[model samples]
Target chain A: MDAAAHDTHDAHDEPHLTPYSVYVGIWLALIALTGVTVLASVVDMKHQAIFVALFVATAKSTLVVLYFMHIAFENRVFWWFLLSAIATFVIFVLLTFADYAYR
Target chain B: MSSDTAMPDLPETNYINAEKGLKSWLTTIDHKRIALMYLIAIGGFFVVAMGLGFMMRLELLNPGEQFLDGAAYNRVLTLHGVIMIFLFIIPSIPAVFGNFCLPIMLGANDVSFPRLNLASWYFYIAGAIVALFSVAAGGVDTGWTFYVPYSANTDANVMLPMFAAFLLGWSSILTGLNFIVTTHRLRAPGMGWRQMPLFVWGIYATSWIAVLATPVIGITLVLVLIERYMGIGIFNATMGGDPILFQHLFWIYSHPAVYVMVLPAMAVVSEIVPVFSQKRIFGYRFIAMSSIAIAAIGSLVWAHHMFTSGMADEGRIIFSFLTFFVSVPSAVKVFNWLATMYKGSIKVDPPMLFAFAFIFLFSIGGFTGLLQGALSVDIHLHDTAFIVAHFHYTMFGGTGVMFFGAMYYWWPKMFGRMYNRTMAYVGFAMFFVGFNTLYFPLFIAGLKGMPRRYADYLPEYHSYHALSTVGSWIMVTGILILFANLIWAIKRGKRAERNPWGGATLEWAVASPPATHQFDGPPEVGEPYDYKIPHLGDDESAGSGADEGKA
Candidate 1:
């Protein structure tokens, strides 16, 4: 394949570049989520704090994957592959926890 | 067709002759060169580890110490396991063939990240140096798995090996990432995902497992290093940390790692069986999807290794059930291979002989795996020679045999030369016979209650040990003959034709050794395993000619 042709192919399908303001907004949202995680850790509602911290961290990372990593603009297959990897990791953690929970 | 007419004259300039000087190879980003570099490194490690294994077997020839004391034996065993698993088998297929063939098979010029591919090789070398350094500094006694508490408590230089493994894990992750991206982005303009060669699909699946599971082990090893150096309470039982947690984490990567080892071999079999059998691959989609299925399902079955490691009954049952289901995908592959060969005009070349051996030996390995999948039976078989036998059968017999098979199948193309056919067969016979002789007795010895990893055995198990020791000698002799044949053939072997096996894959469409830029232009994409297409005749350059003219 021609080098120019490959570059053109990539450029043709490229998503409209996300505006800098939107990236800044996503960055600010991540910071806010981190603050919430810190707040939850400090003011622990016992076991609920763990859940709150996890939720905020997940939200923060999801935001990073979407806008920061540009995964939001990737093809559907890319999304599925990422989802499957995350699902496999979650299953490993859950299955191990199964033993710990019963014990 | 006469053999003289069938073999085409060698290309005037191929990848090997495209450049000159040692620095060119060191700096070249060509995947083929990198693959050769990997072949040298991986082959070197295999020989070293094989010697260590043979020595260990020699020690077990008697009831007591022969040459190595218990400490020396432990270190040798540890190095053998560590080098074989991390250095040799894990990178064997993907690093060598995958780097060389994947992009060409995809009809592309190179991997998506060429420099990163080079860096992965450097990471491998760096990690290998650290591992060798650890050995020189009074080798670690912890087994390859580096099970916790023992690893943390070992006064030997465990930290270097752990860090070494961590670095090697990064190399694995980078290689996986490179392949994943190259497959997604760099395929020829017309080649669809479904149209890819099954070997590419196999690597694609294995890469995902590499990207996902390797990082867990990398982090686990880092934690182990920290625990040892700083006396952290992670996997140390007395420090209120759970040692079982270490097993869970280590196996989380190591178990799926077995699939990492075998899937590419299976992929090679998938490619070789169809070409040599003169038929289309039976159930191509099924075989491709099964690779993915094995990767996904294989990850879940890691805890099967921990059945007797004080895992809860419920966990054991769940893992056992998952383990049984994991076999389904493997069986699908086996059945498809047999079906592909059922009615076809099969050529029993060296590669095919090894493939057939792979099926037979891998079947035994798989069935024995099922035996251990049974929670009740596994408890009895756990930590015994049976487990050791099962692992070698699947690994050495399955992946190891197929690795040699792939070497035979691709040897001509990689080096533009042919090995002595009679010597090839002689070597194969010795390897197949010696491999069985070496491992099969271990199965019997395990059933007779011989524990593995022991420096000594009881008198009742002495016969089995003696037989196994002799078998190791035979096996090593076979391996030596095989290597010697290939080495001698490199200089003296006949020049090979472009498509010697009449393979339909894109790699065969190029020059025997391939060009530095594999394709002059975009390669013509077609069904990868269609044997009905005439070999090295009319359509050989349908895509190449047009692309060359345009270029």
Candidate 2:
């Protein structure tokens, strides 16, 4: 495979490289989310503060993963992989919160 | 320990003898050698942990302070759980047998990432050292669960063992990643997912659990560490944390971790059943899908362990339902194995006997598990000897029994030697009797309300304890004999034929113990369980799994 990829020099054989502009855009989005996070912290949302902070953090990470980290151009296999992992984390948080909610 | 050379002129140049010296072993990227390294390390941990269990059983024999003080007993119990669980059982089948067999079965030279495979072995060793260090450093008494306020504030060296678990989780995650990728990328060109052996499917499912679920424990343990060292109060109740939340986080990983311990044993049984029965595996696809189903459903049921930890009733009901659902796939597997054996020319070898034992023992483990999964029943049986007996039935009786079974099943293929068959039977007879005697009494005792993790018991539980302790001695004697026989076979046993079992898998097509490079080049892929391939089923005591290139 290595030899074929090297010798073919075909465009299809090349890895899907994320454009520089896309990474810069992701970086800017991340900075904007961070600014929002900081601003949100200044005002107390009481029960909503943790949720608000988590949402912004998740948004920043998703952008970084999809664009800056190049999962955007990767195979659908990886997309499902990322989704399942996130789902597992969500189920964990949701179920643990079940105890809190009921109590 | 008779070795009447099954194949006297066995090849001198296989994986074990191909490499020499400790340095070669340490640096080698060969998965088979890495497997042997894990076997020796894990085998030692098993014996040590088994001995700790024996001590616990002995202490329970007559009640009040027989030998170990209560504090000492707590430490011993912790060591037994920590060593057996985190160190021994989790890695036993997958790390040892899966490593030795998976790639070869797939007709590949090695796992997708050979270097990472070796690195996983090193990680395992590093974790093991810290675990042993914890034992030496006055041991941890927080029990294996390492729950709240006590685990948070205890001065007993909790840090090292937690650190060990964290490192071992990395080892597990990496190994699982390697297997997943290997199964995806490295299977021989002709071998489709459907054509792959059921054992591969088992490991494939287990690897995902290892990869996805292990880090939950890593994070949970890190939280505990932070709470302990920094006193940030993530879990210690007095310090403004939630202990029940801690249970949630801990079991989120630990429960699925149970599947990590047993799925590979099921996988081994999948392989052993059809081969010994001399029949095509009935419902191969169902068996394969059940492995996946178990992994997926198994992950969701983690909170079942927390049924009594003040979890919401809704969560308990949901988890309980998922727990019952997970049992369906396992029952499906058992049913299929039975179906495969029905009216087949069943030959009883040591491996087959273990498979038979696995079905029976794991059934006990599974049914008992169902009883606990019921919300109402679990409330009654939460931390009794019943839970202890239940897990041991699955883990030891199920996985541990199959671990030896896998040893016998793959003995010729892995080591190029066959142990004394009669001796194996003798050993297993004691093992079966001792295993039953040891744990069945615990079930009765548990029903009568004996608590687990206690050094002493009430006089009412005395007879049960007495019977169980004696059972442990018998069980250990048998286990030791089994181990000794295998060890004796390595040096003096008769040479084994390449395909001694007439297995249809690619591993049997290679020389016993397999060459450093397993296949000459993508040798034949078969219907993995199909016995109808010519000469493949010839073995009523079949030999020569040499390929006809039949699919």
Q: What share of the true interface contacts does each candidate keep?
A: 0.56, 0.52
True contacts kept of 2: 0.52
Query: Tens digit of lDDT per residue, candidate 2, span B1-551?
Result: 12353344656577888878999999999899999999999999999999999989888889799899999999999999999998999999999999999998888889999999999999999999999999889899999899987898788989999999999999999999999999999999889999999999999999999989999899999999998888798887788889987888888888888899999999999999999888999999999999999998888887888888887787777788888999999999999999999998898989999999999999999999999999999988999999999999988998899999999999988887888899999999999999999999999998889998888878999999999999999999999999999999998777766567768887776766666876656677778877766644332232222222222
Give TM-scores for every candidate, taking all chains together and pairing residue i with residue i.
0.94, 0.95
Give the 10-residue window scoring lowest on summed lDDT in candidate 2 chain B: B542-551
Clashes per candidate, residues 3 or more apart or on different chains: 0, 3
Flag clash pairs in model 2: B5-B494, B7-B495, B539-B542
lDDT of 1 by residue, B407-487 (tens): 999988788788888888988998888889899999999987899899998999988888888888888888888998888
TM-score of chain B of 1: 0.97
Evaluated on CA atoms against the true complex, candidate 2 attains a DockQ of: 0.59
Candidate with best TM-score: 2
Interface RMSD of 1: 1.1
lDDT of 1 by residue, A32-83 (tens): 8888877887785998887897898789889989989989988788799789
